[model samples]
Target: MSLTSTEKCAAAEELIAGGKLEDAEFLLEQVLDSHPLNVTALNAKCGLLMRSGKMAEAKRLLQIASDIAPEDPVVLTNLANVALLENRIGDAIDSLEQAHGARPDYLAAILLLGQVHQMLGQRKEAAEWLTRASALQAEDPDVLAAGAAFELDQQNIVEARRLYEKAVETRPDHIRSLAGLARIRCLAGDFDKAVELAKKAHLLAPQDPESALVLAQVFFQSGALGDADKLIGRFKRRYADYAPIVLLGAEIRIAQGEVQQGLADVAAWFRKAPGDAARLVAFLKLLGKAGDWQRILDMCEKLPAEVRASDAVVSLQEEALLALGRTKEGWQSWARRRNLSGESPCPPVQVTLPPRAPLLDEMVLMRFVDAVARNGRLEVSGETQIPGMWERLSAAASVDWAREAAPDPQLLADLAARATLHAPENGGFRAYLAPEPGRRAMWEAALPSDGRPRVGVFWDARPPGLLIDHLQDALQDLNIHIISLQFDESRHQLRTWRGVLDAGVKLEGPGDLVNLVDCLDLVVGPDGVPLHVAGALGRRGIALLQENHEWYWAGSDRQSIWYPDVERIVLPIGPSWAGAKPALRETLERIVPALHLPVTT
Candidate 1:
């Protein structure tokens, strides 16, 4: 039935309040058709547009309302809300200031302004407003909830948990407080605690899309994939209009290796929520992983001009272009990533061919130095480590004989110092020593009076980024007592070491690590816990290094600055990309002779 203008406006406000935004927008459009200057209808329409996520249209409607009633606190607050949604954080702060100035005790504007500052990475500014809001209303659930979010962002997990618990105590049905607590517990590896909080949140806000999303994430993280799938299905059926549930369900399906099925599932979500930037980027990344570059290119062509120009879409487009071997276009687009606005341009690395020779000479080293000077820094195997730095200098010396410079002892010492103390590139930087009380006493008891070569043996520990299968083979040949510093049941693998050295020892977590360092004759591992601990303790150890790992292990060459008493067993790479397998027989044959070499004066 056609209604009067006043009746239509009231009906729109009722629908908006009920969260039926589509219905509200429809009614507002009909009412605004005749009474174009109806500020109340316009304000309600702006809010409906916001709920629908049509931020541009929301801003337009709010602007019209502001034009009609320029000084209205309500209209100004609505404008600020739209600005916050669009991430115009500074503008949101200004708009909120104006709105609150007109209405001094406006709680909503003050709270949202604080949240905007928090999102902008202005932690101090956010805390100020949040503190003010809390002072104004100590028991307000929303104020307490925002404060908890601020604390969580700062990584003060203890304070965040306390604040969230207080928020829930004050308002038992506060969904934000419940979800925040659940997320923190999940991060701390307490899945059981997280599940309990999530269940409570789901019960309180049964119809809220965010609650269902949080529950699904908690279930997924806890390895209850089936329960997550069921919750997603139930949420979809109940809140068929909700788009986030469908998107999250698709994400879960992708994680579970049902990529094709997940794509089909999210098609409806894309239809309902067109131009979802995050979803579109995620879909492209999935396609890239599956080697579907052609399909990604098709999507790029079909995307709207504005969406294509978006930072996420543009970065994806560039990646697709590069992967498709469009090198010229790819490099041209790469210019966008470079800070070319600076006064001086950064030069590219100069490559000097090494005449396909067996031995790299002083001239070759000179060319390597020139290349490093040109490029600003040398990268070791595409990683910014010292070995990479030396290799580039080696390359520069290859071209120009005059550029060659012998190793400067002082410079070498400084580089080694920096690499030991500051280089976290390969998790090798360990400047601080751990104090091991019990282990140190145990080691003191076992210490030989004559000081026959002390060797520390760490057998069953896997270092980060090592292939576990490879470490097992390497362990069999080394003649050393196996000490297990692993937190898990890898001690069974100590059979090989036991066969060689005839002794086995087990060390617990950090404590065992500290004690093991005190008693070892020489520490040996395929670069595991003992390696870092021994290095930090300034102990002598032999590092069995993987071929490509020399850069990360020793910083430069096969010598370590962190542990001066250490010798590296490196598998030197030859011409081809084939494995750098060391001749173990030859290595063992030379080890005794090399160790017997008189200390170079």
Candidate 2:
């Protein structure tokens, strides 16, 4: 009944596939002890060691396997795996390339190369490799799923969905295809179908880490907290701390108001084994939530050299350093953001936004300060009213601003290929954008009676990073008249305001906003377009920076080089808005009384 070394190695592969690492290890050892140079035995043993978290041992054994069969593609790929585990990205890539070179048609090497190239932001190489893989194994469900996953990561949802559909049709039992489709559904907000797909994936691989994590996330986000909790309990210790399951458990707990305990759990997990990208992002956000800037900085030092350079971590660090008075280092760190790879899914499209990039109108407004720049025309088409300074910007930036709800994609592509786009981060310097005379006159007619200083408030209702839900409560006890300067989709939330004039509805564009801001005693909001506009116009304002902050307003001594006149208030860690209210009152008491002027004539 005894098995040969080859037979034992075959059985060991089955055990590893079943997640029975100990049994797999025993079988591999028996074969390895007799046939020390057996490649199959060594490869299977490496797999078992890696699964058991013995990366060093796995790597050492792989070196021996390489010597035994120097050109073996499988051994070369395992070498890549070990390098990846240690975060040695360059070495991993070299190994993969060598494997592919040795055997260009090696399907395993091709698929892995496609995945790794995508992870490293090598989109051209990834596309090439993926195309090759598809050509080689067009009907294989696994190949179809891998292609879909790569496309999904690049945010090509339609292409990914098409591939996933083909994959499921080819083989409905493929676990990865099911899970990939589930995630796409979740992103599309079809939570019911997402739950169904995730459940099928989990049922197919009840003990698999990825399947469990995906199901748990779908359940949690869809408000099936009880199911998520039970799933977490089932796999809590079965998966390691570095797996996203740990972060998922802590996230569920934090969402339920167990902030302290949830933070502690993540802290311990990150301290022990810290370099998974998703885990690091969540951990750093929680650290900021707890106001632990020093530890966040400390994490930068403790991280693997490759991970420390990630755009996400570095961006967050820039914000932390700015908040901590390390201006020199913060800006230097932030400057690196413009070119970092592998972090962003793709580079910003190269082109001039004539109507210009709408969301970045504030940045564009700053660039229009130069007289020579004002000589161009910008053509833009949109459903909403033309933004303030539309005509002026075309004159300033050489753009022709237009009005169209739907623009032709071909026209945009042609314009972008040759258009000159402008950026406002010009050495932190800017010229003031003056309010249009007519809009200023209209705003003057709507000014409040002279007495209790009028302050325009813009707490974004969408709450990307700032949301003070109790704006009414904060203003109900103050002496100031709160004008609703909020705009866009967030303007509708002002219906509940008592005795407030909804002036946000009146804004025509950035120029209109400038006119309103120019007339107010003070403008108050989180760091946003309004605050950015206020600073550009040399107006007084209070900018509330919460735990999750952007580096756009990075300046030392609570001053932004871009908005030096505005009072910068960094909200202390913790999600509560209790601290912001006090700062608001103090800034108003000190500044509003010093200037009692009427709306600008």
Candidate 3:
């Protein structure tokens, strides 16, 4: 007994609704044979195939559905979905645009189009579409939440909070909206509000790791590590079956300086779930620190072929091997990684220098400059993108030589032409210090001729939080009458210090900060505005860098060519917690002993 086309289609729909996907596909094919242009059957089958991860089949059915009903919104939206899933971003945009044009008030089409634009990095257009979508569906909690998240990502906290608040008002239990609000509050240093929202999110979605993670971040920010520890334990217990959450917990623990315990937990989790690539990469980097090189090499050997092929992991493997002195194999691995790093856009450098190295002469430095101009690409250096060969070479040379060669006019022209600069601080040259007054009285009053050596202290800068304790320790050991040029003196700030260095030390505000920097015999601090001021004032100082040399300092050696008067104390390349802190203390100990004056005591 053969069924009619309509009957077969209805049967397929029933089968699909009943969760019998294979049966639905079979029935749908039978129906399609009798009625090849059936839009309803085609659209339904397209949706089914898409849900089942059959992208090609879904696209074909969606195309057929579109051809059958040229003006149909549903068919066009499905086509757009298929295109987006296939990563045909431009095609997805076109299809969604047409769909939106056909049905101008279609909220889903507008939202999908906006998402595609956002993913393609067209945030401006995405925002426009999102705004229109919000107007069309003003009460949509998801739309409002997405808008809030985008604004938050843009660092517009006030706008993001407003949108997030609206989303919560519309649907109070919306997890994403709650999480967005919590993140914004956390960023704004309102940990109490952040904690409240995060707790509400966790209550709403008991099994969600995201809410728990947000809570952990808030706790970490507020220095409530014990609370974070307890919440993370709850998170692990609840989501013990998942791998990423466990790895994330380990990362948080390590961040709080429980390195051994964190590493052990991470290793245990990796043994259970070896298939997760991100976690695998993270653990490999961690092992690259102090773990047995043979163990890391063994792990590399057992890595899945696909993971081994990943450039990031491959580079890590090579660098680790090189650091461990497996030079021959390491070079081979490096060759592979160099290829994986892709071709350089800049020309090749072939300049040579004499074998004898010393304080760089003008001729040697010019050869360096010519080689760079010929070969190296100009880039913006910061705490992330370390300067390239040209900038690095310049940063390592004498300031007098570099100034003569790379003058403001030539450097500015080059930077403008190339859309980059040799050094980030070259243009404008805005030194943070007010120029010292010409009058002799200001100078005489500012500089104390005390035989005790008017030692200065500045214990403030932006860093990864751990370094602050190290800074405090270094300050404590100096045992001098130190004055703080403290910037973040407010109680509400994230990086607050409560007389950690010493109770006898005087904490100065912005005005006193400047005055004290003017008066001090020797200034010392991390990379902060005061450091810059001290350098410009020709005051000898030391910079305690949190990261390695290549990170932000931009030179291979400890001495800074940028600020020749200011010596640099960098954390060593190898991962020892004792390195940066102890090195600073020793440097301080050595210098303090040389001050031929009596101790304050």
lDDT digits (tens) for residues 1-601 of candidate 2 = 9999989999998777555677888988888888989999999899777755666688799989999997898898888777655545667788889999999988878888887788666889888998999899887887898889888876678989999989889877777788899999998768889999998987765655667778988887776666786888666654444336677787666544456786888877766645456557778977765556678899778878788888778877876876565655664554445432212111222123333233444343334323223433334443222345443332334444344433332123222112212222323344456677786888887888767677788875432235536456555666667788887676777776777778888777656787788887777787667776677677777888754354445556467654677887776433355477677666655664475523221
- Scanning candidate 2 in windows of ten residues, the lowest lDDT window is 342-351
Candidate number achieving the greatest lDDT relative to the actual structure: 2
Model 3, span 1-601: residue lDDT tens = 9887778778886665444667888988887777888887897788677645566777787877877797787688888777654434566778788888899998778888777777655789989999998888777887887788777766666888899899889777777788888888877667788889888876665444556777777776665666777877876764553444566576556655566777798787666656656557767766644333456678888877988888767777665554443434554565444332222224222222222212112221232233334334322221111112222232223211221222112222122112112232222122223332343245336444555565555553222333445556555544354544554532223234453323113423332344456566667776655665566445667886643221123333555644555778865332223566667666666666555524332
Query: Using Cα atoms with residue i matched to residue i, what is each candidate's TM-score against the true structure?
Result: 0.45, 0.59, 0.50
Positional deviation of 330 in candidate 1, in angstroms?
33
TM-score winner: 2
Query: Residue by residue across 1-601, what tens digits does model 1's lDDT show?
Result: 8788788888887665444666777888888887888888888888776655466777788888998898777788888776544434456678889988998777778788788778656788888888789889978887888888888887777888999999889877688899899989987768889999998887765544566778888987766767888888876664453445666676566555565777777665555545566557666765654345567789989988987777667766665655554533543454454322312212222222222211212211222233233435432111111222232232333322224333321122122222222332321322334344665677657554343344445442321223334444444444444344444445555554444332234444443555656566556555555675566555666666543342224323545643555666654221121231243233433554543322121
Model 1 residue 282 CA deviation in Å: 19
lDDT of 1: 0.57
Error of 1 at 16 (Å): 9.6
TM-score rank, highest first?
Answer: 2, 3, 1
The better-scoring model by lDDT among 2 and 3 is 2
Model 3: how far residue 601 lies from native, Å: 8.9
Can you give the lDDT of residue 166 in candidate 3?
Answer: 92
Error of 2 at 420 (Å): 21
RMSD values for the candidates in order, in angstroms, are 15.2, 9.5, 13.4
TM-score of candidate 2 relative to the true fold: 0.59
